[model samples]
Target: MQPVINYLNTNSGEIINSLGQHLTISFIAAIIAILIAVPLAIILINHRKIGELVLQITSVIQTIPSLAILGLLIPLVGIGTIPAIIALVLYALMPVFANTYAGLTNIDPLLMEAADAFGVSWRFKLFKIQIPLALPMILTGIRQAVVMIIGTATLAALIGGGGLGTYILLGIQTNNNNALIVGAVLAAALALIASGLIRLLAKVPLKYLTFAIIGIFTLAGIGWGVKSLEFQQQETITIAGKMGGEPEILINMYKDIIENDQPQIKVKLKPNFGGTSFLFKGLQSQKIDVYPEFTGTVLQSLVKTDKAIPHRPRLAYQQAQKLLQSQYKMTYLAPMQYQNGYAVVVRRSTAAKYHLHTIADLTQFPALKAAFDPDFYQQSDGYPGLKKFYHLHFQNVKTMEPALRYEALAKGKVAVTDGYTTDPQIKKYKLVVLNDSRSFFPPYQGAPLVRTEFARSHPQIIKSLNKLQGQITTKQMQTMNYQVTVQHKKASQVAHQFLQQHGFLVQKSSKR
Candidate 1:
């Protein structure tokens, strides 16, 4: 609830902006659908042959799952609010089209006779008689479409489109329930509000449209004023994953950097310190500017295949850099000193009881549940590839969060979890960090990903980020991890302290 309230309070301005945008998207679609559907409905009501085709076509559209529609648009249109809005508009069309036609054509024939007897033109008949009678049913269709579009709009967050869906996606990634609740509630409330507004619009006197326009403009100005004043200095950036162990360490470092040493940059660094899929999309779509990525992660994720031979960090980074440049049209710059990748760990008690020292011993424990970080190394390098490479497999394989995976081991929930080699908890919890013996996991050296074009214009961004490569050692990352997880300092505080300790601050930071 605190996160939800914080999100709502902090993002009222964004919500306001989205309300306008969402309305524009929905209204435009509704209008177009009505224009097309209503006329078609009239023609179809008179001509039975065409009616079946039209209904079948709309049903076909309605049958396509909403997620499929959005995913289908990704490669064609890429990502952002435009693709999301377009997909949502299509999702909304059928209801309005079907409803408008039904309402218009369903009007009683007696009313048409009375209008004809009065010598009313088609325009007058539609305006004064048919429309007046059809308004209730038409509004019903509009209301349903509003509800459907608003629900689907949550999916927009995946494409870098701004909406309440951002909250829901954040909530899912962070394992924070408050974000999900706020996203669900506010969107539901907005749908209701839209329904009410449409009803009120129906009652509004025709002449009052001008007054309504004036009021809308006045409110828009006020909204802009509120936005300008409220979030003026706030900055937002995406982190790109949720629950990977060392990656979470990277994000915590960033938060630590922003909060303790640099106050001038007020950042709303996003919640992606887990898996890179969302971040992958965000970066490709130009939604994210930068994030901590790794040489090996790149070799696999962007390069699209795991090499049979694992190379040294430098070789891996150089090859991945070239691949990213040529394939993703992105740049991979600098590598951190530390190396981290898949290590199999077991509880000290479990290890001691069974003498679980290596893969040979681990395979003996058949009853154990296994949890992995749900990404590259764990999926392929740690498990599937390991099975193929070394012929090993645990009976129960599950994807899980990094932080929780520790507790899962401690509590005996899972006997093994993929861990980074230098994780501090390996000492704290007395878990046995087993040797690969074969080293099937590839090298995962850290690097920052900056877009090719952005880096070309702002070379300093690459330099500034690259400075951190050798700066944060494996031991130092472990210490920072302890600060956030054990000492309970926020990630931003840790980042800032690390920066000031090492002098990454600008003189303007004096005020902060």
Candidate 2:
């Protein structure tokens, strides 16, 4: 509880900012959904066949997973609030549309007939007769849709859409329960508050309710538009990182270096943005200016190669650099002095109990329950190749998120898991990394990858980034990861300390 309090105290600004983003995205999506759905529902009220068909389509959209929808939108619209809002609007459509159609159709047929017999205009029939009675049901649908949008907006953080989901992802990646609690509690609170607002609005007259909803959303949209315009006016460079404490720390370092070097150029950091593929696609689409990538990941995952990449760090880095330039038109900057390569890890107690000393030793325990990171389980350079080379198979294999794997292993829920060499949990949990005697996993040296055109145009930024080359050693990286993940330090603070300690930044004077 104390740690959570401290976390909140330190991150209140970020929390408020994220809350704003969450609200804006939710409000905009809800408003758009309402505008589209209510009109269509009203129009289709007279056309039962088209109404039924539209409802069926929206219902189908509701069945699709939010993540899948985001994935599909990435190629078309790319990442950020646009795709996130689109996905949320799609999800919000069904509830509002269904309920609106149901409400209008299920209204007292006798009242509708009486209005018609009175020779009231169609407008009066809709606004005065049908809408007044159907307001509760329509508002109920809006409430449901608003609440759903608020909850689902968390996933927006994955694609650089700012929201409380950023904290949730960071929490999971760094094992910071405090962040998780804050994000979850705030999201739930937002949903509840939205539901309550709608309930209160239910009591208002239909005319006032309509005006209120429009005015509120209009102000929100204006505020969001202004914020977006402000960002667009700035000379901003968006730098992103993969999910984990190390990537987060590195990106902060990148931000600090670039901002300090060129104060005129603003640096936006998107830490724990997503997996390798997502970041790569973001780079390709110019959604992100730069991100940290590994030589081994490039060789195995990005570049098309029939032959295996050599396990040597220097050679692998060279090949990755050249291939990315020639094939992908991206520049792989000089890497820091660390190899955050893959490792098979187990609890020290488990290793001692089983006398496991190497990868080959794992072959003895076919029944051992192994938990692997999702990417590690599927990537060619990870479990697939290791399994074929070592002939080791675990019957109880589960693919887990990167952070959860360590927790599972530490708690004795699993006997083995995959990890990076510099993972802080290795030290915290007293885990033993089984030696890759056969050297199955390739060396993964961390480097800043940038688009070639961006690199050419922003040589100064590249130079600022190059200051990291050979600066961070394996031990330094492990220690930094430990600081962020175990010691619960902010990545920005840690990066600042590292830069100051290493004389990369000027120390500030203390005024008496």
Candidate 3:
């Protein structure tokens, strides 16, 4: 209770801003869905034949997983509000459109014919008769859409669409129950508010309800306009980040440096961009200029070779650098000193019980249950390779989101799980990381990856970025992650403080 209270107090401004974003996203998406779905429903009502197909198409879209839709949109729209809004609009369309189509098509033929016999305009007939009669059903559809959009809007954070989900994602990643609950509660509250407001319309006079709806939209528009002003710019340099605390911090650091040093470039950050493959496509399409990437990920996934590389960070970085340059016209910048490799971790109690100290110790526990993130589960350095190298097999190997794995281990749900060496949760949960004696997992030293052309064009920018080389250590990164995830600090604030403390960013004295 104290943690939750402290979280709310500390993050009040952020929560307010996130609430605005969440509402804005859901409202706009519902509006867009309404605009399209209602009009299409009207058109289709007259052409009953095509209405079935249109509703079915929208129904199919609703069936697609929200995360999958967001994933599919990232390569196409390159993350942020655009992709998030597009996906939400698609999700919102089904309920609103289906109800609208049903209401309009199910209208009495006698009334419509009377409206026709009155020599009224199709537009007039719709507004005067069809729309008024369909108002209840239409409003119900909108209410459903608004509520649905509120829920789906949380996923917006996965693709850099800032909302309450920011707190949720960070909380899960950092294992902060307070932040997660706060975010979840806020999102749910917003949904309830939207539903209650729409329900209010049912008890009001139709004319007043029309004005109330207009007023709601008008206020939403104003809120959106105000928020847009804060981020208004024709950004030239877009720094992207994959999902996770480390990448977000890196992108924030990059944004701070570039905007401070090269103001003319108009830097922007697209955080929570999809994983390696998605970001690779974004770079190829010029949707992103630069992003933080891991050396092992580049070598294993992007470069697409299973050939073993040198274990030393410098050697591995050089190998990845040469390969990326030759094959993809991409360049790797100076590596951050920290290595965020996969840690085969177990609860301290489990480690003590099994006398586990290294990967070889894991071989003794054939019945151990292992869990990992999807990417790790499929990667070369993941379960399969680890099993082959160490001649060990877990009784069960489960794949889940990286964030959930720590919680699972903490609850003793699994004996072992994959983890990043630099995750703060490792310290929080008092876990033991088995030493990779066999060197099964590759070293994943953090580094920035950029298009070769982009790097060449901005040599000075590259020079400033190189200042970060070998700056962040494993402990420093873990603490920073803890600060944001556990302490609820802003990523920009955390990054700025780190840079200033380390002499990378000099603080300007305030004028009296």
Candidate 4:
């Protein structure tokens, strides 16, 4: 079994990485949508038919499936946030534009006639009479648009945007109910609170006196909220997490601590999820307070030195921690029981036909096609290294989400694919996990990367996390994951149940 830390880190990190991409794209798109929609609204204000057509177009944009929309945009704009932002912006256009148009159109013609009678310029009538009267309604539209974008923006992760949706994606793929519940609930709450505040402001009768009062109060409230969520309370402690794979293990465990543990501590998630380069950058930036890290990965990426060592688990743990402490001022905490490293997965049929028992045997084949997780870093020491060391290369290398990759591998869309050594699908799919003959992929010992400041300020957090050491066997992690994804339980509920069953938490609260 691999260490518990590695298992969690590998699983949970992908969620945050995806989420960051999702949020960045959504917010930018919302802003662009507001900009484009408002001007178009102003132009079509007097034309009822054109205004209707604009609304319909926006509605149509909203109707398309979000991933489909993103895919459609990718070819034209390429990968990452620009195309994603455009898609989200198109989605957000209707509410703002529609409301603005309605507010403008609803303005009394009598007022316009009266202003014209006094030789009031058209610009003056629009700026003074129409706009002033329409401000509240336009704000209402904006409020609606904001809410829509917040929700729809979750899909931005499918492309390459970043935001809060990271948790949602991880929770979904790993079947971590707690992660999902937290993500979904927070998203809904954010939208509700944001929209509610917008409504309250819009409701205030337009007055110069109220504007200053409201602005001051709003700013104060924002400051208060930020401080409240920050300025760690007596119950608060920091948590660090990576972007993909085993990060889930630690996150779920931390989530369980927050949810069901005794002497509760509020969790401040310092999530650092991104691609390999991105995660290393996050580590350099100190954006992450703690994260699950692998032994060999630490050696290869951080040390940038290759010292051939015996394939011993304890040595991997010691070496990984040593590098983190000396180089990063990061404390490497107690490792979890289970470890997750690379494994070759293929259809049950392929395994049987080829009689493939190891990476070496599979290399004998020609025209290899494989799928790898895009978020997975160190494909070099893992899969790509396997290729180079063994002198094997595939004809096709497809990159996709881990979830989608399974289906492709199963259907023979690809001959073999990458997988977690412990993923339960190895059982469910009846797939084969080929052995590593030379053991070229060094042991990926899992341990928590604890920031020095956090260790000083909240040592208890480490001790609390340490309790799960030797608890999360690969098989255990796999089964728990199955309960959530295949069985479709809520991530929060599953985490709580697992903690209780494992005796990590006593007097467990019944599932909510």
Q: Which numbered prediction scores highest in TM-score against the true structure?
A: 2
lDDT value, residue 440 of candidate 4: 69
What's every prediction's RMSD, in angstroms?
5.2, 3.2, 3.9, 9.8
Please give the TM-score that candidate 2 achieves against the real structure.
Answer: 0.90
- lDDT values, one for every candidate: 0.68, 0.89, 0.83, 0.68
Worst 10 residues of 4 by lDDT: 1-10
TM-score of model number 4: 0.61
Write model 1 residue lDDT over 1-512, tens digit each, in one string.
Answer: 56556656655654566556556555555555556666666666566667767777887888898779877887777666667777876776677667767777788899889889999898888777776777677667877887888778777766656567766665565444655687778788888888888788777664474498578768867977997776675544444434323454566455444443445444444432224665676677766676777777777666765455265667777788888898888888778787766688888888888888776677667667888887634465667776676666678878887657877888888888878866767666778887777666777777778788878965644555665766777677777766644443445556667777877654324434
* lDDT score at residue 58, model 3, on the 0-100 scale: 92
Estimated TM-score per prediction? 0.77, 0.90, 0.83, 0.61
lDDT of 2 by residue, 264-323 (tens): 777888776777888898899888999999998899889987766988788989999989
User: What tens digits encode model 3's per-residue C-alpha lDDT throughout 1-512?
Assistant: 88799879876866787888887788778889999999999888878779988888998998999888887877677866788899989988889998988888888999988888989998898888888888889889999999989998898877667888887876776567887899999999989988998888777977887798789878877977986775575447788887666787999888777666766566767666656776787787787888998888888778855668777778889999999999999989989888899888999999889899998898778898888899878866687788788898888889988778888999989889988888888877878888998777778888889999989988978987888888799989989987776566767779888877877755431310
lDDT of 2: 0.89
Identify the superior model by lDDT, candidate 3 or candidate 4: 3
lDDT (C-alpha) at residue 43 in model 4: 89
Instruction: Compare candidates 1 and 3 on TM-score and give the better one.
Output: 3
Residue-level lDDT of model 4, residues 248-339, one tens digit each, is 44576675664455355555554434344434444455444556677767776776445664477788878777777887787777777776
lDDT accuracy of residue 409 in candidate 2? 91
For lDDT, the strongest prediction is: 2
Instruction: List candidate 4 segments past 4 Å from native.
Output: 1-164, 167-233, 240-246, 255-264, 268-288, 302-311, 367-369, 373-378, 393-401, 506-512
